[model samples]
Target: MTLYPVEAGNFKLDGGAMFGVVPKSLWNRTNPADSNNMIDIAARCLLIEEGDKLILIDTGMGDKQSEKFFSYYYPWGDHSIDKSLKKYGFHRDEITDLFMTHLHFDHCGGSIQWNKDRTGYEPAFKNARFWSNEEHWLWATQPNEREKASFLKENIIPMEQSGKLHFLEREKDEVFSENKELGFGVLFVDGHTDKQMIPHIDYKGKKLVFMADLLPTAGHIPLPYVMGYDTRPLLTLPEKKKFLETAANDNYYLFLEHDAHNEIITLKHTEKGIRLDKTHTFNEIFN
Candidate 1:
């Protein structure tokens, strides 16, 4: 099984929002902010190429949103899904599965794009079966006021409308379950958003986890460093605590999704609880 780090896009977000409640004095040390207090963020999606399956996890912010809409998040990079895919000699049309960790605009935004005529939105990857769980599908479609902004209709509905959206069922009380079709286990996390699926893949004899929002960056290794955007920060505490502890114990290589600088990270059990031990590039480890 070959795993590729797909560079979807690069953008910047408010450091305060990224690191909730945590004092700037603390988080700024790891994720330093610019003059506008914005920190660099990457829509670092993952591409899993195993046998006949070509699964792409979390398409980054597509170039469909209006300039005014995108101005809010300072996008500053030439890296794109097309360029990255082409770098690895692939294209969006080749993706068989589009597994989104959640339906947030940044994560799933690239899943849909304006049609040739720009008359309406359509599935960006026409050949792909878009994946989202039943619970998250409902949560995203019928979003609450707090999360409404993140769940955009244009970025979501087109998949279901296109008749290619698929749901992964997680039995009640099942924290981690294997998806035979995707050939990986997804850890169900709700603190960030309802039922955000974190992929746990057994890649080339090493355990690699897609660190969606559960642990956005190596800086978020501490238990108290949850994102402010999370619907329930309290719930994030235990969810992060449990998962991070397990990650540290199991020696899992965390594939960071949103960190612009750090690609992959490993954790260690320190006196201050689980902390980032070392960071690695996808090529250094996976290649």
Candidate 2:
């Protein structure tokens, strides 16, 4: 099996929103803010190539949204999914599975795109089976007022409309360890979003956990630095604490989705709490 780090794109978001109640004086040390108080955010996705299947985890924000719509969040960066895939000599059509961690626009927007005629949306990965759990599918489709802005219909509905959407059956707090076909176990956490699936991939005797929004960056290693975007910030506290404890104990490498500078990080049990032990590139760990 081979894993590739796909750089979908980058955007800017309010540092205050990203760090929740954490002060700018504190978070600015790790993720400095611009004059407008916006911090860099990456739509980093992961590509897993095993035998006949090429599975992509999380599609970054696509370029289909209107300029006026995208003006709210400044999307900037030369890196794109097409360019990243070409770097690895792969194409979107080669992807057999599109595993979404959640349905947030930044995470799943690339799943669908405008058709040639510009009449309607179509599945971006024409050959892949889009995977989203039943609970999250419902949660995103019937979004609550707080999360409605993040879950865009154009980014999600097309996958199901294309007749390629597949639901992964797992309850909250359930871990899918018996599924060997994917060569990874899925841990379902609901604090960030309902039934968000984090993949626990076993690679070269090491455990690599995809830290979606649960831990957006290494700076978020601290238990209190929850994002304001999280629907249930209070519930995220214990969930993060518990996960960090286990991650620190087992030496799990976290693959961050939004961290612009850091790609992977490991944790250590510190006097204050679980803290970052090391930061690495994907090649450093997998190569």
Candidate 3:
């Protein structure tokens, strides 16, 4: 199997919100903020090429949102979903599966795009089966006051309307596994968003995990660096701790989605805590 790092684009968000309770003195060292106090972040997506299937995990915030709406996030950078795909000699239509970690705008916004006629929205990848957990799907579709702004209906709905939406069933008492092959396996995490599915795949004998929001960057590997955007910050603490410990012990290479500079990180357990052991580009692991 081959894995590709798809550079969707970059956007800006408040550094404080991204680093949760961690003080600016700390997070700012890793992710510096601009004069406006917004830090640049990458909407880096992952492409899995195995056999006949080409799966894309988390489409970046698409270009369909209005200028006024996008002004808030400040989507910059030359890389884009279409341009990134073309970099690997592929196109949007070649994607067979669209695995959304959650329906948050930054993660799934590129899944749908405005119709050319401006009549309505349309599926960005017409041929792919869009995947989201049943619980998260409902949570995003009928969002609460706090998260409503992040879950835009225009970015969603069109997949279901296009007859491409599918939900992964929940195994309440047991962690879901990929006993049956369907491209890759999904690890459901709720600390960030309800039932956010992190894709775990075996690429060239190494286990690579698409770190959706679980570990947004290498800086977040430290137990206390959970994001403020998470609905359940307390829950995220243990969820992150457990994953970090496991990741360090298992030697899993975390593929970050929001990190502006760091693309991949591997952790090692230290006396202080789990710390980043190595920082490298996606090609180091795949090429």
Candidate 4:
């Protein structure tokens, strides 16, 4: 099995919102803010290539939103899914599975795109079976007021409309063991979003956990830096604490989604609790 880091694009988001109640004095040291206080964020996705299946985990926010809509997030950079795929000699049509960690726009927007006629939306990955759990599917489709803005309909509805959406069956804490096809286990996490699935991939004799919003960046390794956007921020505290302790103990590599500068990180049990042990690039760790 081969894993590739797909660069979807870069965007900016308010540092305060990203760091939640954490003081700027602390987070700014790791993710510095611009004059407008927006920090750089990457919509980095992962591509898993096994025998006959090419599975993509998360498709960064697509380019379908209006200028006014995109202005809010300040999408930047020239890196795109197409370009990244081409870099590795792959194409959209080759993907057999689109595994979404959650339905947030930044994570799943690339699942669909405007049709050629511009009349309606269509599945971006024409050949892939889109994956989302039943719980997260419902949570995103019938979003609460706090999360409604992040779960854009255009980015989601088309997956089901295309008749390729598949829901993974997983109860709380259930782990999907490594299989020859996917080469990974899936751990369901709800603190960031209801039933968000975090992929536990086995690569090169090491375990790499895709850190979706649960641990957006290495700076978020601390237990208290939960995002304010989470519907239940309180639940994130213990969830993060437990996850970090296990990650540190097992020497797991964290694949960050939103961290612009850092791709992977490892944790150590420090006096102040679990802290970042080191950071690595995809090639550094896997190659």
Best by lDDT: 1
The reply for model 4, stretches above 4 Å from the true place, is: 171-181
lDDT (C-alpha, whole model) for all candidates: 0.93, 0.90, 0.87, 0.90
Report residue 153 deviation for candidate 3 (angstroms).
0.7
Clashes of 4: 0
Model 3 C-alpha lDDT per residue in residues 102-155, reported as the tens digit of each score: 999999999999889999999989899998877888999999888999999998
lDDT of 2 by residue, 1-287 (tens): 88899999999999999999999999999999999999999999999999999999999989899999789789887999999999999999999999999999999999899999999999888999998888899999999999999999999998888898998865445545334666678877788899888888888888988888999988888989999998889989998999999999999989999999999999998789899999999999889
Measured on C-alpha atoms, candidate 4 has an lDDT of: 0.90
| Reference-based TM-score of each model | 0.99, 0.97, 0.97, 0.97
Off by over 4 Å in 2: 171-178
Model 2: colliding residue pairs:
none
Residue 132 lDDT in candidate 3: 80
Per-residue error for 133 in candidate 4, Å, reads: 0.6
TM-score, cand. 1 vs. native: 0.99
lDDT of 4 by residue, 1-287 (tens): 89999999999999999999999999999999999999999999999999899999999998888999899999888999999999999999999999999999999999899999999999998999998888789999999988999999999888888888888765545544343445678877778889888899888899989989989988887888988778788888887888899999999999999999999999998788889999999998888
Could you report the Cα RMSD, in angstroms, for every candidate shown?
0.8, 1.2, 1.2, 1.4
Worst 10 residues of 2 by lDDT: 170-179
Residue 5 lDDT, candidate 1, scale 0-100:
93
